[model samples]
Target chain A: MRPMPGNAAERGYALSEVSCDALLREFRKDFRIFAPVRLEGRGRFSDTDMVRYGEIRNFREMELREKSLFSPKEVLFPPSETLFHFAETGVREPSLLREDGKGLLVLLRACDIAGVDRLDAIFLGNGPEKDPYYEARRKRVVFALIECGPLGASRSGSFGSCFCVSMGTNRASGYALVLRPEDDGLSLFLEDPAFAAYLPPDAVRTSYAPSFPLEDPFPVRVPDPGDMSRAVREESLFSAAFWKDYDSRCIACGRCNTVCPTCSCFTTYDVTYEENASAGERRRVWAGCHVDRFTDMAGGHRFREKYGARMRFKTMHKIHDFHLRFGRHMCVGCGRCDDACPEYISFAACIDRVSRVVDAAASTGGDDHDAR
Target chain B: MPRDIVRKKITKNAYRITSKRAETCLRVRVPGGHLDACLLDVVRSIAERFGDGTVHLTTRQGFEIPGIPWERMAEVNKAVRPLLEALEVPLGVTFVDLDGGYPGAGTRNISACIGNRVCPFANYDTTALAGRIEAAVFPHDFHVKIAVTGCPNDCIKAHMQDFGIIGQAMVEQDASRCIGCEACAKNCLKRVTGAISMKNNRAVRDPRRCIGCGECVLVCPTGAWSRDPRKYFRMVILGRTGKKNPRMAATFLEWADEEVVLTVLRNCYAFIDAHIDRSLPKEHLGYIVDRAGWPAFREAVLQGVSLDPPLRVAETLEFSGYFYERDRVFR
Candidate 1:
């Protein structure tokens, strides 16, 4: 069911801290819950900590204040997944289900929920044949939407790099549960009727409505997908002088791709065991357009050698190309790429630049060369 | 009339007799080369009031106020009490008289590079370690020089000192997180030792060639390579610069934890006291180590110190320096 703010009173329930723990304990029997957790001293630098998604045992382990350095896409689409194992006889698919046959319950923010929809478009609805490896995991996954309130005591309207409101992804629906941290306990909106049975009988009925962030500290103007598509067809945006600056700036570290929730590109390879050369497993690993050798062919030839070309390819794919095929822009504007770029390249600024270029080209009757 | 200045007492008080007959210079010690900005007012007032209104930044990361009259040494010592209390007293250095200025000047100021507090390349806080070293070895007349560098880059010129403490990072990789991007491998090959190589779509590090510079950890995009929480250090010993011989230090200990480094450094003083040539007014630590062979020196310093499994002690030291004797240099 699509949960709306007006009808939240009909579905909302308040649970004490102990009751919430009890409810999670009950849910744990059938679902493996994943949420952002703090990993001490696991950051890129020394004496630093990073928050990333991991299988959480209880609510106390979840890091709710800060945005996770990585997205929850790894739960449904892992970094490396083995499709099947092959030997002299025949091929056998790896067991896709968990040992307990438990489903996946992910706690994420609204923008990431939107990001999951984009991933769905690519993996499940991109072409005639669905990706079997992704489908098996996708079918078992559900979401718990975490309320994006004023971030800690500082009450910063949004994370500095996020522009989810500008991209119209600040609000999301179709979550099994909606959780808001209250002073005494937790106020939950049980949107999916199936989840109400899992709640403790002691849960108190309450009138509560979760609010979505309407503004961001950093906002971007996303170009109209139709205008971007037309610009792509005319080849104006591809050859725009704006992309040349990235040649010197970007280090091609692929951090942006690895952190992106919607980036779904992968490359398949076969690995043979050292002991038995004939016994091997076919695996698919996440690939990024910015990384080296992404477009390498059989010969020595490669595409997008200059970092600028790779930036252009990624920008068009995120804003224009995928929108043409899927009826929605692939980017959810979570701005994780901005946060993760070591070179400090801002994807939000790039989107604004694309909007300017597209507007300039349209205003000049599609003959603008100095649009940048 | 000529001034009746007691040179030994004045020198011990951190006063330098300058070329001018009656003028002297006061050297202020700044451990770790890091100090509060408020302490600069004391230095500025002292220079303006006592000296020729000028201050020299010493090579050892200390402040040297020149052109001070020798007769005003007493007043200058009183003026510098604040500096002493701020920089030295807090580091556990005990002062006989807080108003008497520096108790000893033979051991130079412990210099350090901008460490993990500022530089991304640094593995640990060099300034903090330098302060600890200062606390352990200061207030003595050893005529020894020591420097701490954040990494193997040796930015503080630690190789030119009697004792050089270099930061080391124990880098480890998580194979599952690696995407075979080769960023770390490429950076290591180009800028550092080629310790990492890509094999089977993952980085395989050769620990033998790894200098523990942490370039792999710095350049990694996926954070597959990270520094171990426990800090380690590489100690290079007996490098010196003088008219007799000047050479870079060689590695004496590798993968030494903080306790081992501190104990070894503290024990070096006793080794020097036992073997120093008393005929001369003062002897550098390097010359004493040269007079006594490396084995004797090693034995003396390693007394009561336990070497952990990961710590590697040097089996032998081969010093590369030139003798100033004409017979040895003549072709």
Candidate 2:
């Protein structure tokens, strides 16, 4: 149903009461609740049975304010799922198949929210009918927006962070429990006044003031899709020197795919029981595009083998090629690729660097100026 | 007409104009520009005016319009000349399957993961290696799917491709960090060989017992651990656990180069190209290898290498090399 302010059709609640009873009850019915928690000396989103409301004392207690340490893509599209159950005879049927009308609830920072929206455009809107399995999980949930307050110290991260401000995803308005703490305790702003009445005095500070963008002007601009093909072709002229540096630092963890909201690729397997060889489950799990084995079809003919070439595929798909084919950038600038990277390969920075090279090359008009 | 390649539906704005009476299919793409929208409309209008009112989406992410007769090819090309320039989309010999054969499964052939640079389970830089392989090998007509995963978790399913590589960690567990917590002992599915008996309820891993899946590393609460920076990757050949005779692939090589990997892949492809009849329809690589005899063919095609004992003599009809052709890169 289309969202409407509470009146005859719907109603609002105070943020505190939403957190106290209503929110927890509503959340528990569907979601396996998750919030930021300290685990093994670091903070992360993990499942805990400690509180009925799945406690988040304040925004500070929330996991990384910059963006989620992990992307919520796993909530719907897990690392691995059973594609179907099978027997040795080649006959099979679905096992643990998720129903089509399920939903999920995620506490998302603005960047990831944007990422999900981008994913919606790719997976649900433009392409085929949303994958029935993915759609079942996607349609079931809602988003709870959390505003990022400030950057942390040791900021080894890039100055041109994939900030929500630049990505046009700094704030959310669909279904939120905005927090503002005052004297009584913590004040929660809710949609329903009845939910609001249950709040302790001065517990929640309610204000309509919206946070301003962290920096004045958004620094990044998407490279035009029209210029991509020639730019990519030109990039191939450069030798392996440029690629070797990036490859040296790479650790093939596949986290960037996991954290990316729009990375919808997957792989499948037919898992069978040991004793009951007649029965096994077929599983489909998320697969990354940046792996050595990803392109080896039959007979060992690998299509893309150079580090530079793989980088070319990723950047082009995100900015150029995908846009040409699907009319949208595959990336939403969530910056998870930057943060999740231990060696700290920033996708945004990479794009920015490549775009400069492309622009310079384009201006030269295909002349071999550097290497004679 | 092949029923497999029949007219499923007719959509507009996908392909260039087609003739009203041709047996073979002709696909034309509009160039890339703002005029793409306009060209889409123009192409759609033309298709309706001359032939059918629909276009087909191919696995390579291109569009095709059928019902074109051979005689009208020149006329069709002539009619769409202006629009082609404006659109900037090129049309040529397009393979029906380019990406993963299943779009629902994701990008195929040259698939790469984000890698350990960002992931918790990473043993090494899978992205770098995957990228290295993608660029160096130089592709052939038949797409070869290569997969790379950073750790034993096998997140990318590297073991399932024609050629696959998975990163493994060299690690040692400190006894002092052992809290007797059964988490590591319990979480391990491989039943790693190295583990000190549980004491004070905490279990310690014997360096020898670890298969290096890192499940214990992930679950361990005590910070008592040392991991080597030099995580090694194991190369796996021919592993597709899919329909039509699924099988688990075996390890082929270990500790090879970015260059060595490329050399082996190129040589293998050259072998397949030389031996397999391109004119005939071939379902998979294993099928050809099975029919052709593995040892004799390997001797002829992959001349330089010392053939692994298991691969050379394994009797399983489906060799590990030719699995499934999922994405644009067929495997």
Candidate 3:
């Protein structure tokens, strides 16, 4: 095992399943705990089940075996949010603030914690004005990092389409707590001192430093960020023929964007009540670049008309464009997009394809010509 | 030497009279067209040992082993006991004697299409439903043919049976989850009935046009469409292929539940018994229903059945088929 990083051993505590449940009950009083939960018979097909993020009150409710179909982003950024209500007198913003001022304790994997960091870049650090809606939820959230697997023996392939190691998102550091599921119970490493009060009084102390997966079971080759940036600067990758195949293959269902960990796009619209014409609410719903009407302007003009062009725009935003400004790629490689896609389009494979194009361009002396 | 053998008794005992004198064929009833692969060895052993080493896969999903001598009928009956015990006994089919093979062959094998266990389009398990029907009305001397199809596609040729139980999925749509991709709508328009259409960037399904094929549920990327867990069925009645009035089945019950289907099937036997011509050696179910007329047939079968609001009972049925006497029109 790797050495515990900086006093991690001092914070480690071993709790039996019984005590862990007790600790969860105590946490539930002040914080709404969210974790991946197995919803029976709620899958796309009949007699099937799906695992997604939901509110959980007990440790046993958490589904640790399978990777969630959707990322933990939904807890902070809901699918639909009513911005403000309009009336003859004035407009009033809905109070999304919790009544008890309770915080959100989310249990997620290391890759998802990294995904949240990328989301932070988009919502909070992108420009001068931070999104207030996202800031409201972000300020009251703390993470409990769930161990994906043992060091050097990750179950990434079992998770299907995961390539976090290649994207350098297999490890995370900002989480307040680390939960390692053991055969008998749970081994928790708490970073935040305040959270330690919630632990059971009789909880046994142990030397359990959380281990990050060293390698992905399903590994993909990712191009160097610098090489990707150079390819983008040349403007050759944008018009490359690699995206043309997706015109027919991709149905533009936007399922990839829906399940993406870092996709932060939203479209706002007003809904008027039937009884009162002017009295209704303004709502913001999650939108995707691949979806229709995502780029609609005032004059009925739109961008990325073709499905392949949308794919190109999304790929560049996730890998090259975001990195140019933020010093890192937007994708954390959780691979939920790869999982949720009904058309079986692999975003990881697309990244690898981008890597190949970058290498081909580099081999040809970095010319301005199209890589394809 | 020619032997004096009683033909009627042996025919009822699941043995067929072949053209070759003193030779017979043994009919093995495989309910729902599904069986344990290991049980095939029993069929193989009987063919190789007692009869000519050839097995005919019957249209009603059964095995007919030919070239067995009439004298060895007892042995064949003894050999087929294992099949009866395995396939019949577990399905709640009561047997008087374990050694006695199929007591009656007038009610043919309950056939079914491969269902949701494998096929994506199938709403429910057809084989299990077939088995359930077999348990309800089997071991009887009534000439009836029944088939179960997974969807409206009718891969099992259910339209040609006396009773066809076609599976239907009651789909529910969540507009909030819909991304207006039009995948389901376009697919429904091109392949299935044009039941779905885009309205204000959301899919609007017409219940009247929808056949409950579950194609929308299969194609929806955002899971806007889903099958209601409660299974519903559409039953078509009195279709047959014969010398007299061979006709395709017509709709009798739509959006019926499992209990309704099984009850109707059970009620059909009484309807057949009350109207069958006793003088004839055997009468097909369609001819009996035709003789009794549609109203009398419907009244008899729906005696105790409680028709729910959504469930529609056909007021009339017009069968489409050709007659042997209609050869003059063909000329």
Candidate 4:
């Protein structure tokens, strides 16, 4: 893979300028562009001004200023997707939806790309199961990187629970194209020469500058493994006040999971048509761990009976368990959960509290060490 | 066609699903979780015309109709127009413009504990109060959650809500008419908060510890410790759970009356309107308040509101019971 813009070699790295309108028209020839667009009212993401990834008609409709309220991952893994059509006789996969055309996802920020990487790890990596649905959709997606607000020392570079700089997810690689708006116009970084033929003859040369700074622009601290591993793995941290407190506070509304880019947990169901019992469809819909029935299993045993326990499991997985296997934190620190939660539960703040409590326990000679 | 309707998870009023192929689910917002039983037919119409003739009861005590096609959302909304119109509230009337679609789901349906209307331990009628609040705040585009519980038994889980309101009845004991039954003292110690005790054959309240839950007032058969005529509620602020720190709301106002609560709530909108970050997609009220320090927020919410004894605001709120400002170590 090529080094990110500033560090990459100039040869074959032709930086140019393209108006957003012309770029959208050019990209439409090759792939269907899914960009962030504002809806008339509260869309699926539920906020009035929410920006969500959707198939766009014009570049003017694209919302690029703020982070997408809903993740672009849905382009690959839909909220509710039909797996196949079934019948009394036999089952068969539905006609491939991608037959319309390949999809081009544009303006994905650093944390979002990181989110996609995590999704790839869970869905398409060297895992026991490779999701054919996600794999098929993922194969046709053309990734395009978009730079966030103009680089400046005056601002935090991130807003509202966003801590990508501290989470080490402020930068990403592996994109077919990069769009960074400058004082003049939208600067286009064309790394792949394969797309050079699509560019206009007037495309100008420009050098890429690092946006904001690679380091944290604010005081926000990222979750640390040191605070978690010792107290979470070695000690019974479940008994802490953190886990017990959320029982009443978490209403199990499941908005947090729906807004979360990394929350990939899903539940599959079969629905037979009423008109024709012989014909049916097996579908997978987004399921939230925070939901009370999410833990119900065979024989009536529930893994996470209480909301607090469910919250603990979710927090531990995002900050600890996933990291133990992937060597990286699962959370991209987008803070959409904070914006989405009606109860005002701040997942970003929970990471900090969990770290503090765990680190405190680690330093204070935890009780019942003999058991650990 | 509405230009930006992607017809994904939900439309304005309908929840779009992909089960058995694409479908739309209609959500019914019954304020205070209490609606006219006759409205069932409006639901029947929606279920028959737009849905698969089935309704799903939501945990929040509302109703959801399943299996309407995504394209038929407008028709579904049109069918439910009567039900939405029947609400008769100015907010509800304006909200019905979406035809029957949930008009900009900013204000959530208020959930309340059945109070003095039925329950014996209630300090006040929760359903009535929730309806009052719902009318005052609905159809707005600011995200604020309010839950009302009758007494400290907290069956409604008030502490978890953004603006958790628990009814409180200030106990005024008259020693002259004491029965010396020690009922108030015994109940206070056994079931209620230990804020009362028997002293000289009279129930004496520890003013400092009294959460004003009114258990003593309820058990006082001799009427020595009757509730003060003024209705009051304890207000908790901010509570939330998220990526960093999750916290139960801190007590903001005690012995607050309906006027104070309403004023504070209305003022909250003013504060939010003034401070919300337009650059971001959306901002939580708590986040906006956090940006403006608690003191500034306090001033903003309590601008014209007045308070007296038993209704005094904490000099400095220290939410030690759970997480908030001080609980988290991270930024």
For this target, which candidate reaches the highest lDDT against the unseen true structure?
1
Ranking by TM-score: 1, 3, 4, 2
- How well does each candidate superpose onto the true structure, as a TM-score? 0.93, 0.46, 0.88, 0.50
The candidate 2 chain A region of ten consecutive residues with least summed lDDT is A44-53
**Would candidate 3 be rated incorrect, acceptable, medium or high by CAPRI criteria?**
acceptable
Looking at model 1, residue A288 earns an lDDT score of 95
Better of 2 and 4 by lDDT: 4
Candidate whose DockQ is highest:
1
Rank candidates by lDDT, best first.
1, 3, 4, 2
Where does the lowest 10-residue lDDT sum fall in candidate 4 chain A? A40-49
lDDT of each prediction vs. the true structure? 0.86, 0.50, 0.84, 0.69
| Pairs in clash, predicted candidate 3 | none
lDDT (10s digit) by residue, model 1, range A212-331: 887877778999999987877777888789899999999998999999999999888888899999998887888999999999999889999999999999998998889889888889
Give residue B328's lDDT in candidate 2 (0 to 100): 36
Each candidate's fnat, listed in order, reads 0.51, 0.00, 0.25, 0.00
Alpha carbon deviation, residue B94, candidate 1 (Å) = 2.6
Q: What DockQ, between 0 and 1, does each candidate earn?
A: 0.57, 0.01, 0.38, 0.01
Query: Could you report the Cα RMSD, in angstroms, for every candidate shown?
Result: 3.1, 28.7, 4.1, 28.6
Clashes of 1: 0
Q: Write down the lDDT that model 4 would get.
A: 0.69
Clashes of 3: 0
Candidate with more favorable, higher DockQ: 1 or 2: 1
Displacement of the residue A24 alpha carbon in candidate 4, Å? 1.6
